[model samples]
Target: MEHRFDLLGSGWVSVECDPKSYRLSSGNQKRALAIRQLIDSAYNPIDWQLDFKSGYRWRADRLSGTLRYGHEPAVDVKVPWELARLHHLSWLAQSGDEKSIREFRNQVLDFAAANPPGYGVNWLCTMDVAIRAANIIIAYDLFISQGIEFDEAFLGEFHALIVAHGKHIMANLEWHDVHRANHYLADIVGLLFVAAYLPCTDESNAWLIFSVEQMINEVERQFTPDGANFEASTSYHRLSAEMVVYGTALVLGLPKDKKAILGGKNSFPDWYFERLERMAEFCVHVTKPNGRVAQIGDNDSGRFFKICPSFDEAGGTFKEQHLDHRSTVAAINGLFEREDFEEFSGPDVALDTTVVSALAGGQKITSYLKPGDNPGAMGVQITGGVDSGLSVLAQTFIEPVDATVLNGLTVFSYPDFGLFIWRSSRFFMSVRCGPVGQNGNGGHAHNDQLAIELNIDGEDWIADPGTYLYTPAPNDRNAYRSVHAHAAPKIGDKEPSRLDFGLFRLENNVDARCLCFSPDGFEGRHAGYGVPLHRHIEIQDGKIRITDLISGTKSSKVIPRIVKDGTSLRKLWSLDLRFSPGYGIRD
Candidate 1:
């Protein structure tokens, strides 16, 4: 087969190897099975179980269709369906199922016929277009690699689709002033993928340079020196980090001779890889024993690629299921050939060794963590040795810091991001006492300042009310970002930080500081609500205690909103409220 472009040298990529070599994890296989079943049943997996073909109006959870983007009803429907179709087809193509391949090809042709360039809801948001373009490229690559050939006309249409996507993204890139969040990152990644994988042309070359420059600049601007995503949202952190990984892989996977030609002046520097490694490590540190992360601020459950299934076997939604952070870490390990990262891999998470093996040469990849000299040297501080009785899951790649390192209460402070984690044998609590969002705009940030999430005995008790929707519904959007939605104290019905006019934007940057720290407790204060509000947290044995102190304001009524699951207002002396288990779900 003659190649039009060489993404990983002049050879043709193939998946005609042993199935075991590319096998996804059991959890991912379950998700793939679900997708396969949905396809076999002639049901679209992302219709939100609603009949879009009929006149049934689509609504975001309980939010009315009359709100926000409701004017363009198809905008919400197209993105998810496009994502589901691409993922379903990609999985089947990777598996080399002939019938599925035929179906996928037919679907691709059908979609192109139905939705022309810039005509459908799928093209409404440049971000969604970018996502679809990347997914199509990946699916097409997998299909060709599996020896499935398309007619020249089909190929022409596909290439034209790519061209249309590229022009759309270049013209409508999501660069709104200083609001460079995960959306902007995804746009550039899509452009880079299109630029690299497609045949070289003047426009493609220009896009390659422009995307590489923007990506490099965004990496430095969006992330702190400590590698924390400036948005302060764990879900967005993963999204942004994956974009970095994908961009890095695209560049590094190129032939050595073509490296200079592709990279040009905006070449990735040494610090870029180092920063990426640190970002992955940050994901590792923040992950809980149950394979879930702390939903610090707003969590929309956004993802870049879904090669492996992200579902758990119990049939829960995306938010109910745990995100496999280890998969991304494994890809990074394979990309950089860093044996040090092997400690972060485990059997429970899915591993795409095909992508890894293709990008990095065939190397023995293990799912077990091995002890090394100075294991703590990988960026995070470690102090304590493993206690024999601790569960294997509780034991992290970094050695458990000595209780004394906690100074007595096991507290880890990321001062750059103003994040503090306090842990005891039976409890874990995370406090967000930092600037409200990043880059002075807080584009992806919520208005939950000095909020906290608590976990007791591996069960989330007081938790963050996850972000329900973005931009589509105005009232629900504001409700989720309200002070009453978080586990924080509000003064006279006032928010600690001010929410800006745009979606997911917050202003009046809160000035917060950790005033005191000890082995048994932490003390912090913020002045975002026109008064100094202080919180003191103490954990002794299994008992948890929290105290709030407000100063500089008299006659100011303080209403504390403590969000907990499985409790009622009748049980406690407060008003009962519903919580969003995931994005677009409130219960």
Candidate 2:
């Protein structure tokens, strides 16, 4: 069996030797130690102890061994085990201890033996399988580089396990109709990685061809022309971008004729790299001064890997870490040699040579021309409706504005995605004024049409209520995606977009646009509640004014809502309510 060792480098540098070399963040050593203790006590570390499967339809305590893995109906056991991340293995690999490495090897072998080809919670989701495959491949490379020797039999079993995973993923591709997000992207990336590096055979060659086509199509289908993800979720955007990065690297590392044959007329590397640059720039633009991107849409805290410390370290899980935007920026910068992206660079910015080495295959990365600049900023100012104390920003301006005035303020408008950002020294705000989401009911889009998020005094004052969970508790899922959860007005209890299908699906897109933009303020309108609702936003003198006007109707009233944390619910005209600060969290 001939392996394509030429794709990825011969071996990856161990994390112990160069801690900051890879984009992956340091593992939770504490969790690893606890697992070690459990293993020493003859307890299987793979057993799901914590009940992370609460609100889902079928719940069980896998730790107590009450629920059989493959026998359980409609239960997703991935959450409980968290095996997809392979953080435990990462911790052990980082430890560099002989015993820990041995334990890691044994644990993996034990899992393969117990799970077999198609059994248990591990094989439930093909996306999870793909993730596990990629991590294992990386781990194997890392271990071999560290002088950890595996007998031929053990190596054969591991290789067979990976092939099995590749087959499973290829057999059951997770392509949601017109709603392909990170999961599907991950599936393709994992397949490509296995096909590229694993021992080359007829099966591997077939998988590679199929994955290349699908990956290219998915990139165009999922990413907006303006560079934003069609799903309209910042978290998913990062995840999908990472998939593109990894997939592109593998494809680029292929032999010249092989790449040409795989990617016919158009060059796959050039196509993917173009989008990669756009995706990276989009991340940079949306990122806040604090190095965190706006949580504008659904955030399940999913990632290809934990490449940074958990953002909510005190109470959140390892998966809940902020997407490693800095590492992504660094990777893009290093590969493309674009210095303009420096403005978005953070202190944590460090290039991960793993990706570079994989792409280069022992060759030096050649310098490329830097891409053009991203959209320049335009200033904004608020003008009207100060006395009403209503959070009213205008949407439709009746008067024509001057061109010079429009150019003064720093404003970014992604017309394709229907997102607008206006920033000044003291205040930064983003408005959602566009289609509900991509084609065929955007699975990741929230009903936040005409909704606005405000960061005043450098603090997020008004925000979009993030997606709490998917397919877990129906009520919570619906509530988080509802208009009530956003900073948008509800017209007679009608949602801008209807939840027509499952947890993530939406119907009836609200067409919204920025009708007028100037240094003074922004005006936009949306048609979702059988009437055009206009919103006008103005920023001036450390104060914001928002005005809402309903057109083509008078009897139907519009109640503008704002979501904030630690606020009183005192009623003057209507009932006041508190809102959730984040997913699975309420104040």
- Top of the candidates by lDDT: 1
Model 1 poorest 10 in a row by lDDT: 390-399
Lowest lDDT sum, 10 consecutive residues, model 2, at 1-10
Q: Give the TM-score of candidate 2.
A: 0.75
What are the per-residue Cα lDDT tens digits for candidate 1 across 435-473? 666676766666666667666556655567667666446
Tens-digit lDDT track of model 2 for 1-587 = 01111101111111111111211112333323332332333423333222233322222212122335433333334354444346446546655577776666666654554444444445556777787787777666567667878766567667877888898898878887856667788899889878876655778878888888888888888887556787777777877776776666667667765565565444454445566667777777676544556676777655564333234445432223353476666555545555555455544444333444455454333333334534322232223332222333222221112222223346766666667786544445678876656575667878787777655445555556566545435676788788877777566677877876766677754776677765556778777776667777765533345667776543344454432221311121122324443334444
Q: Where in model 1 is the C-alpha error above 4 Å? A: 1-85, 256-258, 263-266, 315-324, 336-345, 353-357, 360-410, 423-426, 516-519, 553-576
In order, candidate lDDTs are 0.58, 0.58
Query: Model 2, which residues run further than 4 Å from truth?
Result: 1-43, 48-78, 145-148, 255-266, 269-271, 309-320, 340-409, 424-426, 540-542, 554-587
